[model samples]
Target: MPPSLPSPSSVTRAAITLPILARAASTTSAGTAVTPNKPPPSKDHHVHTYSPEAFPLGYTVSSTHAGIKKKAGALDLGILVSTSDTPCSAAACMTRNVFKAAPVTVTSELLRNSNGRAKGFIINSGCANAVTGKKGLEDAWSMSNTTTSQLPPSGAQSDKEGTLVMSTGVIGQHLPISSILDKIPELIRTLDDSPKSWLDLSKAFMTTDTFPKLRAKTFKIGDRLIRMAGIDKGAGMIAPNMGPPQPPHATLLGVIATDAAIKPEDLQNALNYAVDRSFNNITVDGDMSTNDTILCLANGAAGSAEHGGRETEEKMKELTEKANPEEFGIFKEQLREFAEELAQLVVRDGEGATKFVTIRVKGAPTYEIANAVAKSVANSSLFKTAMYGEDANWGRILCAVGYTPLSPNPISPTSVSVSFLPPAASSNTTPLRLLTNGEPEPNIDEARASEILKEEDLEIEIDLGDGNEEAKVWTCDFSHEYVTINGSAEEEEGWMYD
Candidate 1:
């Protein structure tokens, strides 16, 4: 639920600026097309895309903050209105933290107020309206209200185009809402449904992120085939949560749009289920944030009324409930796979990260304990530092396992088994110096370990040997460049681990 919105006075208005288009590639994929040695099945996979016509419900998206990362200059606010306003339906997942941002709080309320229906999103990045107390809350709402004043109500039984607002940047600072508000009119005047428009709106909401993250999928919900478009932003302060109801202190913001005809309740249910396995399951540094948010807006533009009125929603609900694993198994797998790809992009872009690390923990007391242990090890600065140094620090791995709270009783260090496989020719590997726990086989080679650490992808496995519990954690090796990029390390390059 959203906190009480302060009176409009809490927020002031700045003069409006003319909307200007940014110079970016019309392409909507996350970054320069990933050139894999062996590219996946489809070069242009469904994992990240934005087809202008995908959303018949049409959309109105815009950004007020950009150009900060470069500090070269500034541009006017951006806006992108879709081509249609058909009856829409959508679902979303958000950061599960208690000190939620003002935008997150207000969005939840708007979702309910609009009765689970919405038009699209309006977002800004330079300033995050977080922890500003009453003023922040009012400013977030004010953005929504101002957008509402300019756009027409989505034509539906609900005649209201639900507007969602999002923000990202420093926490606990006052947002320059007046500057954002001042540009609303110009933004509305230039709202075009162009590929460039989509790209600009996406680039507008970036903080430290280097590239834009987006995806599109067409799902067959009965006889209706609906297209879903989504965009997300996150580069630093990541460590998403699943077990806890509240997100850790890391934040992620996203906007999902679809042009399908479905009720809000149904949309919410489907979205919740999708997110549990998607965004909720991923973690980077084990830290969460106060500004995590993922919103979905459906305007029912496609108008597929197979199950007229509540009938369509009811039938889909029944099928979803029965969990006919075989019926929509294909759809489910695609959705899950798409989400994993999206989450991987987040890890690949971790701040100052150079080596992508995958930590797999097996033989734990329980799944819950396994994850806790995995995260404890993965998020450790010591462990990550060791990876960056290319040192096979087996002791840190064992130490992480030993500190895990999952053990029901005390267990000797001998209970655990750890191994370092030199990198395969096709893949990257980690250093294999045995620090502790396992005796180094007399034949264990040293040159092989060094060669393996040079690969771009690295994998590490820890066998707790305690129970059957297991978990997987994704992370990156800490390098001095990371410190330099983040302005944390005093020297231009990071110190050597050795």
Candidate 2:
């Protein structure tokens, strides 16, 4: 947002200048054709997604308010536990911010010490436990220890390496450790595998989200049925660049639990693969969070108790091709669909968001170029505002594409083309081209384009006419509600998060 806007009390969804598009492109402007990677598969190739009604095997959830949130009655604490007799294999991605929140540091350490195994997650809303120095670290460790200590022997022989912690809210504030600690027992007492409890657990850890986000999938390796479920929360600070306990990540908190037996190495591989096409591919405000973390736990409850899941997810050395054991391929595809669904939910629930925008950049020489161009457009405030207003302003979208930094091989408008495709979920396959092969569509249909913009979901198709590689990004349109939400945020005396 610019520093010089007049009183906006009366205005809603006003167009605000964004910094990214303000600067001139280092290369030829988007007016020229440029390169991007490949594009999304045709609609027929869309992943077969599902809405599982049952909970993932062996996991139960409990949630309660512990006065952590400033709002009274706001459920602020949650526990997601795996009751399998043994510690479940785990894989996690955390924020790479230099000033990582206390919980992120502690959870990452526990996963390391336990060698990618854990009981479950203990999360709190309100204080982020970031930048509080040593005290924050101690509180975070205690959060994990205290929550796991009360549970039966499971993931870790000791409680210290059992539970993971996730915290979201305001930064630089200390959590009321005593109060949060006191309520841990109550949370455990209320834990159950009921559907409502799982939903409650999702909302309890949310900050600015207007609704809870969760998804489920059930598939079998051979004849053994395996179930997976995922839950996540984020409305702002949601540009996730997470890696496997590596540098760079998102403050967007998420968990995908499955009862498919898999090795620790394979579980990590699955998470790394799905995240690239899922959480890491979506954005809200483009601000990476200090507390961002995504954890995947496989407790193997679907298999016999004596030996865990009957179908062990074999570790695949290469994910881009078919696995030697065929079954791993099926598991990877299902995992990708599940992760993508959870990530899309965040964009759909973006703070003050009005439109869900899908950007596909195709024909670039490399994945890096395609991803960069897609993000350039996805993060543009100007393009988002245009979508919010339902404006058929193709110029804003083109301008955003033009400004991407592609030195040494700058974009040339002659071969570049742009179009608004029919809704991805719709049966329509035809695209309404605004520009084709570097020339504006001679017979463009303005009314049809306008109709496309009116739809809640829209897809922008850009082709560089360069190569076969491609990339996709999912984002939402910023609106008047966005400015009001960020502009009006004020920390009260007692409330910390949100």
Judging by TM-score against the true structure, name the best candidate.
2
- The Cα RMSD in angstroms, rounded to one decimal, for candidate 1 relative to the true structure is 14.4
The sequence of per-residue lDDT tens digits that candidate 2 reaches over residues 1-498 is 122222222111221321111221133565652222122112222122333345677788999999988788999899999887645888987776677888888887888888888889999987788888999999988988888889877643454458899998888778899999999999988889877787788888788777777667667666556788888988887898888885323158999998876666678887888998889999988888888898999876675322333433342122222343576778778888899888998888787777789999999988888888899889988778767766666666666666677765666657778889878666665798887886667677766776777677899988988888899999998876776667774443433333
Q: What is the RMSD of candidate 2? A: 9.5
All candidates' lDDT scores?
Answer: 0.57, 0.75
Over 4 Å off, model 1:
1-57, 60-86, 157-161, 217-226, 242-250, 259-266, 273-278, 281-284, 298-333, 407-415, 419-442, 465-469, 485-498
Candidate 2: list runs displaced more than 4 Å. Answer: 1-53, 155-160, 247-250, 304-324, 424-429, 491-498
> What's the distance in Å from true for residue 313, model 2?
18
Task: State the displacement of the C-alpha of residue 289, model 1, in Å, after optimal TM-score superposition.
Answer: 1.5
Task: Tell how far residue 41 is off in model 1, in angstroms.
Answer: 25
Clashes of each: 28, 18
